[model samples]
Target: MVIFLAETAQVLAQTPQSLKPAPDAEAGAQAYADNCARCHGPTGAGDGRDSKRMHPRPRKLSEGVFKFRTTASGTPPTDEDLYETISNGLPGSRMPDFQRLPEDVRWQLVYHVKSLSAAFQDKPEPLAFGKDPGKGANLAKGKELYTQLGCNACHGPQGRGNGPSAATLVDQWGDHIDAANLTQGWSYRSGSSPRDVLVRLMTGLDGTPMPSYAEAVKPEEVWDLAYYVHSIQAEPRWSSKVAAVREELGWDKAPRTDLRLSSTFYRNGEIVPSSVRAVSVQAMYNEKEILFRLTWHDRSESRETPSDAAAVVLLEDPNSRWRSGSLRGWTGKTEPAELLSYEDGEWTALLKRPLPSGKRAGLGVMVWDGGNAEQGRHRSNSNWMELILK
Candidate 1:
């Protein structure tokens, strides 16, 4: 029989005093039975009746391995993290948002979820995520540590996930796991903020090949490496809001391309339409910033709700093999241009970023039309297009 005593205690211990009434395990069990058991199994083994049919499959709660967390990878997530996941659900997966549930009920579910794994019996204390090293965030030091720490063995020299050991990696369940392509922060399973990356480095993903660096490097050095990771991020083009500046830069007559886009492959090997078949791109740059005007046709405008959207991705390596293939896994590491869009049957967006000192930049584009229920991993994308800097 699974006991909730320890798990409940853990929750109470971690929760802030203001957010209390300490979660009731009995209540949590009922809530779990009513909602989660259908997909998570009665015992949380991930063998529920619906589990086998789902692509990527439901997570095995008993193993206590989580992909989205604010804590160190191997460490049990805080009660708050669990509450957030329960409330928001995992994007791109079958997990449904439970924001409609009462707050206490959600907290109850957090407790019950913890009870599923004995791994929670002796929870590790949270790590202190110190401040960034400021001026001490040295890229050179970080680059050196990246090599000395053997990160290149798996993450590759360019942080492209093409290292020699990358091909043979697998997770605890023996499912293949890719070495993180460090260039793309938007796709990070746990958020891509600087603090997020720092937590990952210190805690390491518990059940995967990624290990924690808590013992390997000093906290200050970790900050250095974190900043180093930040340094290689693809820079965006920033343009002045002045209309005359835009015209002087020839933004009015920028070259355009109507490129075809297709659905990214689903885990089950299904190919779906991006709802949008084509996209138009017009790009221009001023002395201080760069701008891209994108136009795509769609029947409905989905701005108010979590619906249709688009993105401009810039690659760190122009020669990457993923230049023309699917954008599924590539979005995580690439730098994304900030975008603002307007819609009236046809959607128009102005993507802008700061200009870097380089003569050329690798660029990619993607569109999401929510009318077809497209979001997350489901969308249309283009291969790399080299943007020559003037």
Candidate 2:
């Protein structure tokens, strides 16, 4: 399978590229507020109240953003470029990794910090983080490296904002957009130039889902990602947080239930009306057909309210990326069924149909929080997957 090759040969065989630069300001700002503000000023102007105690004083963020960064010469860093800095902070700087947060968030912060000033415009290309990323020499190699890195699952082919599972993501905003459109020359959140983009990627956005990828993806791979993302640039359909997860969590282990359809959906975890599950389900799938029996359980140590209003369920291969598709159902049975559970946190989807071929498959579950919103907030969780094969 593709995974085996990626794990053994690709990971090592591919030569590492220097940090590719591509940053996201929307994500970076969120990361800054979450971690950096403890010392550096909120706007990065060095006026943060906490900065008063620092011995050397926090660097004036607004005065000049570059001097401290690792850039590509007169140009600013790219998103991938900033990810390196966020994951591994400057040795002499007070910045540290709250890697405890998701990986993309740190990258977002890198984008955020880069947006602090427009200095990136006249900036020259940055020196390679360690070695220079070959100029236009690694596009094919990088594209191969991207899928090998599992980025294809989220970013989609050609970086065209059309990933297999991008349509169902629902965020705190209750709006859905594909992944960030890479082809656009303009930053969806910030940065008038590419360098600003890199910094935000290095720093993660605060109070959001984007995370720094310093630990998992190599620096050269990041550069490759930026290059490919640029290759497919165009009008963006997805912005900072609007995502569809129908692809990630839509898989079935056994076809014992029926499914209608699944889409990437989001919700306000905290504001999910008392008994409601932030993102809930109405039924299960049985062998590609829609079934009604479905249930959910909170089997973790995390604190959570009991769900009664709604629950969530996985629709296997709903997008047809896999061999089979799934059926989906909602409680209200209407276009806008109440998917979120209210008080009863657990529900089991009793399938009307039994296993046909009796095969088990892998699954994906909700893995994000909604964050601060009106009367609601996103919480964190580590939902796992089930198995089925025939």
Candidate 3:
């Protein structure tokens, strides 16, 4: 008896503690009415009274299409994925985190959410994601597959999300949604790891035009495509002196810093989030001159109506006050560095300023996409970034 008791204790010790409670559908239904019905609607059709006012709108739970998941896009996300989203909420959107709720309540909510869609009735198997195919060789093969797969139709030849079809695409809800700019891996709505790309390709974003490539491309080939997609990411440039010919600063040689603009700011008494979520920056300097190269994906080269443009603002005082809430510069009237910009599938700009001495200068970046109706103070901007001269 003693030996048996000891053995039972050992076995129990090895067992993993379950984070979820046995979900109660009844409890979930009540919780949904209390918490989710306002935005998701009573029927989960995404037709809540408030839905129409939101950009990208609330998801249609009945459709069982989720944007963020470790599973392939078409497949239902694992229960854990739903729970995480419910707990942490999606950034730059109206979704609010529910971490304050009890863990058991979250699991129950997941159960109720799944019940809204018949797709979750029978568990859908997740597609298999393969290993990374390294860099150079796979990138070449991936580039070939990119063309063969007709990715250029929506994502553009350079993965800038400016393909001809980009202008016409809409979500299931009839709202406009652009094909992802593959060059900015950091901005992927699902996740940005190589595995995330593979999953996106295999699963495709549900409820949107992005289709799964699981049948069209082999598993190994997906890795190649992912690697190739990663290769086109923009990088920063360094030079001992400012190049007399601007063309000399080839994009490939620049060191790159990719930034995500996920924070929403107040505009015209409403909360406005940046439609352009990511930007790449590179810098080069000589004894007297400094040049910054900035690039961001833009669906339309809006040179006429709204004119696409970018700027870099500098402040001598490191502690200069600039609030995202308002459009005031560090000082009341500091002029921005001179900016020259060009646009194709993407917007590229060169911001030149006199090199700072003594200490590093505080710099801020902003991009205006006229196609999105962004002009004047209404634009996507980043907080201050320090520029250290070496």
Candidate 4:
């Protein structure tokens, strides 16, 4: 009899319905006020005081325009969908996972979030996904389908989100939207498993241009496309060590290291994205000076009045402040010792500075794309990388 009771208790613990608390939006109101209102706003309008600086801004909950969902396109998400998102949070965005909260509290927050949208009044059910034939996924067939299905028009032939129409894409709200950089699996708005890719293919994102492939492809064929896309996902590379190789000849002989750059708004503490993605850097030092050569790709040559530009930022510590003017004497005179040139959609720059009196120094890189209207603090930057000078 004791053994039978133990088995029953285990089954009860595994049951989601048995574990969930009753909905309480009243209790949820205070929780949202305390945790969510700072970014989502008091009325869930997504106009919190902190929202202005955010790229791909917070969702206006009242409109019920969700990006991730299991429901049909243009339909409200199921309650379970809302619960899961509240629990796991949206990856690659400012929204963080709230799993630390008790399951009851999370459920209440879901209830409160749903109350903000009248579209959730009917409690829409999630669309059922068809069986996945992942074991039979064909890479060649998937690649063929990728072109036939016009996926290449927006996602590019190589699935790098650099297709012909990528620059022209926008969300339903008329805000500019970037296509998913397929090579980076972690950046996918929804989860990045084969199953996650399958679901997104079956049920299209509601607010974006990605459409449901349910009618366009056979149920089994969708698995082929999902597997092909998943296969292309490559692990992104990042380096913190900048080795200043002893090269008296020039930058061609310097050791090269690659660093991924991302658009960030320091004031709001957000890592938003812009056109510039990554930069390759080479560092070389002689007896008197060090030279850094930065190379990157930019689609447009934005050299208008507000010109496209790049800078090599030097600092002694994380708290080092800019004294305005130039770096002062490090590059000699009042002007910075930097030269930049662009050609055929590529930027190459050479920065010269005197050797600092330390074993290690903080170095950062910044880029500005005038064509994208990126300027001032609204530019792409790398985190301070440790420069090892021997």
Candidate 5:
């Protein structure tokens, strides 16, 4: 059987130049004003009104220092690099993808972005990359290089970005920098293929402490290291979270389905980046009712009535729309179906409701960390997941 390379590599290698929309800086300026001004500012200064609330705050585009680039350090990224960033956005950061915009508009924004700083005046080209040689790279060799190259110093022994030196690193402008969490490849700003990782290894992130390994490592060996890093990457499995409620014996002992949760955000699209990142869910049902048990970690315990609370919402139900009032503040006739408990920086919430006539329904969750001032709209949430009833 023939196997293809990763799609990310195909995106990088197969994007034809003829298909790109023409570069128009003036049009790009307008697009930037409409889409990016809230965080990046009108002049690309990274001083928008919402910048203060943002962690790892928006990039100061006027400075012309980019973190993800195929070019050598200290040079402006090529136009394609800028286009790719605009299209893909930084996953872990507040910079969201603009792929929804038209191709021409996105191309225009790239030129306008480059025009913000004088560094692009040189119009330098990106460095060339050889084909990935070590396909199923030697994990053992990669582990050795990861140590010999001192990647563990800042990225930790497990690539969790928790090394002893992680807390002390900063960018060129003295802003604090968090080492990339290598295990979460989905959050990688650059594409997460072996080829993509190879690029990062060869061309270090500019303006940050991550240095290029181009001079120190052999080409083949670096490919092996990249493959190993790729192997550690993980992402959430939304499908596995499907709560299949069966009428089996010992309903109370049903296996819990786990799903990861992420921080809530502002109405204007700013993510709060909270500490609560995961939750375990168990669902059981009888002829009369359905019960859901959700457990999650919270460092602080807030007993504030209805404040440090958790709620399970039936998102598809018109009565329990996401924009509805708080758990206790339900303006509708339906009563809130929630029970919560907290102990030792952990939360266990039991939410029960009558079984619907339908065979399947959508369920969602919202968590409030009152100690962290998470109330009202400021809370963690999960996307509506399918609950199968048998």
Candidate 6:
């Protein structure tokens, strides 16, 4: 009888998952609010107590995005992804996983993190940068002015979508977008419009890495970024084969025709190559919840991470700008080299998230050169952009 009782207790402990709530989302919420609110913010915006002093910035869960997960293409992070990040802090960032929390408790905390942005409701309010007449001519000046005004301080050099400050940046999900990749000109959560550009530049995306330019930049300079954004090609590189492989496209609505998404690079553009080029982006859904497929791989014909990246899903938001959110970035990298083959290995990232608005979104990717900045630039390999289309 004693032995049977002991065995039963062990089974109960091992089968804890059989119970509902797993780790108790409600409990996690309170614990997170008390312990993480200071830096992560009550809403998980990554602007907690010490956020201002920290380089780069804290993770903003309100954005409902995470960079270090799955593959280059955004997808739901795996248990290992969460565990590893939680167990070990990033190399050059303020983000530190809750090592003290029990395994089940950590899972509960993940649920709470996901809930931080429930109030965002990224409604399509129409972003207007409001370009004046000279706005057109100021593009070159905007490019130059971007440096003088410190826009590069946050955005990055040349605004090709990289910023030195981003190395330590973290989001609500403990991920980082690093640079905005302004050249893309498309809002991850908002539609890509001149006004959309202005709103982001002027007001800054309140909760996330983007801050209100009103405080840091002049109105005229904001116009310059708008102008430079136009002058700068935010578009990513696309090959006819890859373009035709699954018909990369984007639309005002969720698409599931013969075309499918192989992978997406939020801001693949970079002036310099690092240890590994990392990419990340948040997609906004135009319609209802939907599912898509994605992929990623090295151009050197080498598969570093996984033959298969990860899976992501989408859902229609009753209230959202794009109505969907997607994020993807590099967790680590090895060596780097120049362009090797025109046709090489291609790893896929499968989409499996809720499609909030599902209309538009921010997509990003990376190609690092072991921390070398110049290594990322490639005429044939550098710069990239694509969308889900028919």
Question: What C-alpha lDDT, on a 0 to 100 scale, does residue 220 get in candidate 5?
Answer: 83
lDDT, model 5, position 109: 92
Candidate 6 Cα lDDT to native: 0.42
TM-scores, in order shown? Answer: 0.57, 0.27, 0.71, 0.76, 0.70, 0.34
Q: What are the lDDT scores of the predictions, listed in order?
A: 0.64, 0.39, 0.66, 0.70, 0.69, 0.42
Candidate 5, residues 1-390, lDDT tens digits: the string is 111112343234434778877777778888999999888899989997777656567888999988787788777887777777887777656777787898788888988998898889875557666657655678789989999999988887777666668767888877666677676565566678888888888889987899988879888888889988988775544343456466574546676665656676764566566545556777888887777777765544556543466666653343454554544322121123453665534567776667766666666666775655632223677765666665
Task: List ranges where model 6 is wrong by over 4 Å.
Answer: 1-131, 134-137, 172-174, 186-188, 234-239, 242-390
**Worst window of 10 by summed lDDT in candidate 1:** 1-10
* Candidate 5: residue 247 Cα off by (Å): 13
Q: lDDT by residue for model 6 over 1-390, one digit each (tens)?
A: 000101011001112345425557688888787667887888777777666534336667676554443212222333343444554444334565466777666666665765676432432222233446553556776777678767676555655444556556554344444555454433222323444455446655433565555556666667776657656544433321111112223422332211112212123231222222222222323244333433222222333432112322212222332433432322222222222222322333334344333333322233322222222222111122343312
The true-versus-predicted C-alpha distance at residue 253 of model 3, in Å, is 11
lDDT of 2 by residue, 105-216 (tens): 7656756766776765565343333233546436676678667765555455554334555445443334442344343333233331233334334443322233444455
lDDT per residue as tens, model 3, 45-150: 9887666545668888988888765466567777766876787665445666687788789889988999999878666565556656655347778899999999
Model 1 lDDT at residue 291: 73
Full-model lDDT, candidate 4: 0.70
List model 1 lDDT by residue over 1-390, tens digit each. Answer: 111111011112356658855868899999998989888998899987766535345789988887655565567788776876787664334566687789889988989999999877767557776767777677799999999999888877767555677767787887655676565442244445555567778878777798888888998889888878766643322221111123365755665665556566464444433445456777777777767777765544555445667777665455564543554223332122333544334567776666535666667677876654533333777655666654
**Residue 2's C-alpha lDDT in candidate 6?**
9
Shift in Å, residue 126, candidate 4 = 2.9
Worst 10 residues of 6 by lDDT: 1-10
Per candidate, the number of residue pairs that clash is: 12, 139, 7, 0, 0, 100
Candidate 5, RMSD to the unseen true structure: 7.0
Q: Candidate 4 on 84-121: residue-level lDDT in tens?
A: 67766765566766878887888889889988988886
